[model samples]
Target: MTDVTEEFRLNLAHIDGPLAIATLTGDLDLHTAPGLRTGALEWIGQGHHHLILDLRGVGFCDSSGLSALIGVWHSAKQAGGALELAAAPDRLTRMLTLTGLDSLLTVHPTAQDVLSTHRPTADA
Candidate 1:
């Protein structure tokens, strides 16, 4: 098997609005979760108030990955922002639902789904 470190990739980009997008591909287990966490912190530190983790390419996610996601969510909330998941594969979506995390994590069928629903306030 390939080294998990080499198997993961996280791409960062900014949308037209206040949203920052982190597109994740590959396995998200113990070996790869830290990258996700680090990317989230960097985005938050850069003053991004909204983030979307686009998981359309992710093939797997373990417990540690789930924990990292939750941590990022809390960090965003503490920063007065929000974190959302987009285009999650069916397996990952099922895992979220089975863990009862579906209620806590905002998930959309596509990044556009979140973008369409998330309108900036007049103040923003």
Candidate 2:
């Protein structure tokens, strides 16, 4: 059988405030995981204190990709920021749940939820 290959794309957009969103497309395997990590760190380095990963377009993810995510989460926390995943695929969610990482990594139903939940209160 011939081998099939997938292209990975990571796109970042900064919202009106301190929030930045990274939209990932294609498979998130060992080859693509580095791109995701680089994109996220680039945004954080740009002074974005809050990050949301939009994984709706991600069709596949392997252990390496998940490990990269955990690393990114640690980077965010060390920078005094937070990382959240929005619209993660069912398979990814199940993996996180089974591995007990669902609690460590915040998962939101939608990007809007990420914004609303992390948005700074008026009093703050």
Candidate 3:
């Protein structure tokens, strides 16, 4: 498990096609949400709209994490893009599902699944 005390780190990469994926580790709370937002926006601004977030290593997530995701979704949508979650832990899945976000956002069992199979919808 990652040290929860440390700040979350965002790692970026491009998979097949223009899909830009960010793998997040550590806790995603209010303090780190802004950075997450900025990083994602920077990628989107660069003409990368397909996003896959790998959250399997995330030890903890608060409202800030959820908020950050919502913000990314809205921002990506405005640019005609889509954001999908990959390898979300059960805790995160439960948290998102309880709030009905599971349906709104695509959730995959693993990053590879999202990377290989995800096709952006027409509406984005």
Candidate 4:
């Protein structure tokens, strides 16, 4: 079996108020998805509720990875937060669209775009 962690990398790029930006690189598949979910959930648990997943570095993502994205979205919502995707590759965008997840999750042109548009509420 291939060791997915060797090929995959997830880095928390930035954090501000309730928002966190995570950069995902390499392939996201069955083995790597769980780590992404766990790491994002841990951030949420630590009070960074709104998450922006920067997918610009991601080379590939399989069905399991898509499922993990949904899981993270659900978990974020349950925590009264939200999940957004940034700079998704065309293939991943098509997958999300085909799976009907595009309608459910917001997609941005870039992580900076998300950061520019986000307005932190006084309560947050």
| Best model per lDDT | 4
For each candidate, give its TM-score against the true structure. Answer: 0.88, 0.88, 0.87, 0.92
The best candidate in terms of TM-score:
4
How much is 26 displaced in model 1, in angstroms? Answer: 0.8
Question: Candidate 4's residue-wise lDDT over 69-102, tens digit each?
Answer: 9999999999888899999988999998988889
**lDDT (10s digit) by residue, model 1, range 25-55:** 9899899999999989888877775888999
List RMSD in Å for every model shown.
Answer: 2.2, 2.5, 3.5, 1.9
The TM-score of candidate 1 is 0.88
Q: Write the per-residue lDDT of candidate 2 for residues 1-124, one digit (tens) a residue.
A: 4322378888875564556888888988888889888888887787675788999989888898899999888888887778899999999999999999998888999888887777853222
Candidate ordering by TM-score (highest first): 4, 2, 1, 3
In Å, residue 6's CA in model 1 sits off its true spot by 6.4
Q: Is candidate 1 or candidate 4 better by lDDT?
A: 4
Clashing pairs in 4: none
In lDDT terms, how accurate is model 3? Answer: 0.83
Q: What is the lDDT of residue 23 in candidate 2?
A: 88
As for lDDT, the candidate ahead, 3 or 4, is 4
Task: Using lDDT as the measure, name the better of candidate 2 and candidate 4.
Answer: 4
lDDT of each: 0.84, 0.83, 0.83, 0.89
For 1-124, candidate 3 gives per-residue lDDT tens digits of: 5444456899985644446888998888777888889999998888677889998878888888889999998888888878999988778789888999988778899888986787765444
